[model samples]
Target: MTLTFDGTVLVPVADPDDGERTAAALAPLLTDRSTAVLVNVVEKAGGAPDKASVEQREEYAEEIFERARGPLEATDAAVETEIRYGTDVVDEIFAEARDRDVDAVVFTAREGSRFAELLTGSVARRLVKEAAVPVVALPHGDD
Candidate 1:
């Protein structure tokens, strides 16, 4: 299959360093026709109140987008930043990718303990399994 990142691409930012990592990983896949959307989801509880206010979360999200957009700005890819609030992270990502007609979803692979995986679930794994679009996961070292 011919892989193309010519249309809108979704890059989900999770960790602090994930922005830089995903940017570097996506460079080769992108072309002048590519438009990348840097996304960060703020996981809200089902019924419990959030520790931080919406404005606070939005402010933080903007900072993340700024950092993530830096590398893409230098390239030919058009860059857009977004903040989403949701209870299910995977669903939010898939929804954005489908709604935007994303050509690919790029993210960094995170290694977590079994307990952690059981509790929060693996976003990368779930996305790869459920996402209709291509999911590119860049392997990460233990840091």
Candidate 2:
């Protein structure tokens, strides 16, 4: 039998562009019976001038979800949104996926500076290595 993605999918997005790309990439996988949860995690930090309050972060996450949801509007897939606050983004993503009993986790990879990777680690990499369910990382491209 040909393998297919036919259940709930957990999509974690870090930015609006990433969210858009991810939504487009997953469009073909989604069906009338499928469910997709779009999530954005606001990384919590201590004593930072640039840090946004939880409420502000939630608002931003909502915007990201809206951008992501645009591509799925034509599909029959049931869509959902979430905003989570955590220091460990990878853990929170996995927790959310597991809690929702998702069949797969979808995300996109983007090139980052070495310092940025060192400081935040790579959520895509971590999810690929540790996620219990299938992890799908759309190739980095303008598409």
Candidate 3:
């Protein structure tokens, strides 16, 4: 069955480095309210990976998901996992949100994407311009 959500939100995790903390920050923001569907963009670079490489990457991603899935599950919450491949990060994220029928998207950005926004003005200009649901950009602090 196609998942219908009373409280499903999409969180686009770009950095493998900060996925854990990003998910942690989002938990309290959502805990009493809704369930979170975590998405990790594999990023199709248009280059093919051999079967072994593909398996290794998939294994790594699964480990990441298990770590990220915790905070959401604490409140008897549920999550939908999706692995999508796309060229542009924002485009891929928006596509996932649309595909999942999510209500909102929460994105965490490192110092770099944040600086890009500071220079350009929109934290995520594309999503702000054209996402199907509301977009929330959570900026990560620089270490």
Residue-wise C-alpha lDDT for candidate 2, range 1-143, written one tens digit per residue: 53346789899998888888889877766788989999898887745554876778878888888898988998999999888777788888988998999988987787788799889787777998887888987654465
Q: Which candidate is the best by lDDT?
A: 2
What clash pairs does model 2 have? Answer: none
Poorest 10 consecutive residues by lDDT, candidate 2: 45-54
Off by over 4 Å in 1: 1-4, 140-143
Model 1 global lDDT (CA atoms, 0 to 1): 0.81
TM-score of 3: 0.71
In angstroms, the error of model 1 at 105 is 1.3
Per-residue C-alpha lDDT of model 1 across residues 62-99, encoded as one tens digit per residue: 77777777667678878888788899999999888988
TM agreement with the true structure for every prediction: 0.87, 0.87, 0.71
Candidate 1 lDDT score at position 90:
90
Backbone clashes, candidate 2: 0
How much is 43 displaced in model 1, in angstroms? 1.1
Tell me the spans in candidate 3 whose CA falls farther than 4 Å from its real position.
Answer: 1-6, 31-33, 47-52, 113-125, 139-143
